[model samples]
Target: MDFEKIQNEIGGFSRYQVVVITTVAWLAFSAGFGTQSAVFISAIPKYRCAVPPIDDPDVYPSLGESDIKNYTIPYDTATAEYDSCNRYDYNLSSCQGDGDLSCVTFDEDPGTIPCDQGYHYDQTYYKETTRTQWDLVCER
Candidate 1:
C-alpha cells in the first residue's frame, strides 16, 4: 500500500533498456505493416487477353515450296486471321504469323513494330517467349 516506493521503482529504468524496448517496438510495427501491404497487393487480379485460338488450314496453311515469299500478312488478333507464308525463327517472326516465335532463332527481337497504315505490334508475355499480334481491330 506504499505509493511512493512503487513510483520510485517503476521510474528507475536505464537508458540502454529504454532504447532496446523502443527498437523492438519499431521493428514489430514495421514488419506488421509490410506484411499487410504485400497481402493487399497480391489479392488484386490482373487483366489478360481473351482471344480464341486460331486453327484453320486454309486460313493458316503451311508455306509452300516457293523460294521467295511475298509480303507476309502477320496474325491479326482482332480478326483471328493468320498468314501462312511468313518464315520466322526466334528473331524476326511476326506475331500475326505464328505464336511460337521466340528470340532463340531468328534475329528479329520481340518488341513493337509500327507500320504505314497505323498498324502496330502488340507485345504480350506468353510462357517462355514474348508474343506479338496486330493491334488493329474492327469496331462492333
Candidate 2:
C-alpha cells in the first residue's frame, strides 16, 4: 500500500469528529457543573459552639458571647484557627466564670470532646446553607 496516498486521503481530524468531541466535552462539563452545584447548595457551613444564654442562672451565670468564645471553643495552634467541632472538656455546667475556661494547651487536656451544645454557623460567606434545614454538622 501507498503510505503517502493514505496519509493524504486521511488528512487531519474531520469536522464531524470535532463536533462530536465538542458535544461530548460540553455534556461532560454540564453534568459535572450540575453535580457540583447540587453539592454546594446542599453543603453545610462550618459551625462552632453556640452562644450561651444570658438568662440561664445555673450554667455560666452572667456569661456573655465573648466569654463563651474565649473559653469553650478549642483552638488550632498550627492554623491559628478554632476547631469546628471539638470543644474544651469544661462543660457549661462546670464552668463558673471566664477564668475557668481552658483555652490554652488543648492537646494537653485529654478530656477534649465534641461540642455538646448547639452549633453556630459561620455565615460570613453564605447567607444560608443546608445546615439550616438539616442538622448535619457534628460527628462523623
Candidate 3:
C-alpha cells in the first residue's frame, strides 16, 4: 500500500527512474508553455486613435505627424497619455481657405467623440498583435 516501500522493494530510485520522471516532467512543462503561448502572442499592445490623412493638400496645408496628433488626440489626465478611444471633434473647414495649418480647430470644452476612424497601434514590441489584426482596442 505504501508507494515508497513498494518502490524500494522493487529497486528504489534508480537513474532510469530519475531520467523517466524528469523526461515526463519536462514534457509537461514544455506543453504548458505551448498551450499558453497565445497569451503572449495575442497580447494587446499600446494603441491610440488613427489620425486622418489630409484629403486635399491645396485646401488644407500639410501638417506633420506630431502636429496632427497633438491637434486631434485629447490628453487623458487619468492615464497621463493621449486617449485611445476618443479624439477631439475637429473642424477642418477653417483650414479650407487660409494657408495656415493652425487654422484647424476643435472644441476642447465639450467636444470629445469615440474614434470613428480606425486606430494606430504601437508595434515597437509586437509588429501585429490581436489588437492590431482585428481592431480590438477601439471602442464602438
Worst 10 residues of 2 by lDDT: 96-105
Give the clashing pairs for model 1. Answer: 74-96, 75-96, 75-97, 90-102, 90-106, 91-106, 91-107, 91-108, 92-108
The CA lDDT at 132 in model 1 is: 23
Better of 1 and 3 by lDDT: 3
lDDT tens per residue, model 3, 16-55: 9999999999999999999988865687887777644433
Error of 1 at 37 (Å): 3.3
The lDDT per prediction is 0.36, 0.63, 0.69
**Candidate 3: worst 10 consecutive residues by lDDT?**
51-60
Candidate 2 wrong stretches, greater than 4 Å? 1-44, 54-67, 94-110, 124-127, 138-140
Q: What's each prediction's TM-score?
A: 0.26, 0.47, 0.54
- The digit string of per-residue lDDT tens for model 1 on 37-134 reads 74343321211222111122342355331211222234557876443322222223233444332222334533323232322222343221111233
Query: What order do you get sorting by TM-score, best first?
Result: 3, 2, 1
In candidate 2, the residue pairs with backbone N, CA or C atoms under 3 Å apart (3 or more residues apart, or in different chains) clash, namely none
lDDT of 2 by residue, 1-140 (tens): 88777766888557976999999999999899888787546857667766344214364565654555556676789998787777766545544443444423345654667766667776767777666545577663
